[model samples]
Target: MKKVIISLFALVAGTGFAVAEDAGCEAFKWPVTREQALFAAAPATPSGGTLAVGAAADLALVPVDKAAFAVPPEHAPGEGTFGAVASVAVPPEGAIQISLSGEAWIDVIQDGKAVKSAGYSGVKTCPGIRKSVRFKLAAGPATIQFSGAKKAELKVAVLTPE
Candidate 1:
């Protein structure tokens, strides 16, 4: 009994796996705040499918917290940008594809810098509605950073070679 109790305690403490504390739309029983709404917009992976983000409404230059949208920085030199850190182990020559959505702009970043940026303007079923980009991985794992969106929601996915 003592050993079992200690093992259970150790398991929870050792690994950082905890129940999904962030209540999804339930916590805010009544009036919902912008922050709450924004977080809720995050996309969830289905049973079997590629991962990506989604937006609920048309996002403008300024994003209302809790609103489902992608983050797009402005056109300024150091303006529109998003931050993401990735270091995946690659065997040899490999490539990956990144998909994004929302009313904001997004840039594909690697190694703490922006490699490619795509401007996303919303039109009815037109090109800017939702966008995607692809990048060929280098020899090893690489870090990526994205930025430059005025007020848009964004999502990213990494597709490895099969």
Candidate 2:
């Protein structure tokens, strides 16, 4: 019985002897199933884009030089990187979530100042999205800036928390 239980744990743990972790979308620390679903149905948005609540956007980013940010990014991208500046409507609850499909620097700016992140979770092994950051916003318009992305294209989802 002891050996059987140990074998079961190893299999579930993906110890490499029998199974391995695929590290799928379900692996994030917090559930991002909705964001994952949004990515599939999202449409591309240009640099001066507006992402509605509960929707995703395949952000059509540009070279760092042309991102035209309202306030400069905290982490400026070196040559050959990509970025985008977009807006999202914050709900009255003042809590919002932003999810990304790849690695990049995220800045949420409101009222001409950068908004600090309240919570963040990321999973490198997940394929479609890399991180999700939450913020307590002012329940109005907010600017989201992305910089230092390896590619000129990154998928993003902006939504109110569930």
TM-scores of the candidates are 0.36, 0.84
Candidate with maximal lDDT: 2
lDDT of 2: 0.87
Model 1: per-residue Cα lDDT over 65-119, one tens digit each: 3222223323332334323222344336545444334333344434545545332
| Residues 29-65 of candidate 2: C-alpha lDDT, one tens digit per residue | 6789898898998898898889888889999889988
Best by TM-score: 2
RMSD to truth, every model: 18.6, 4.1
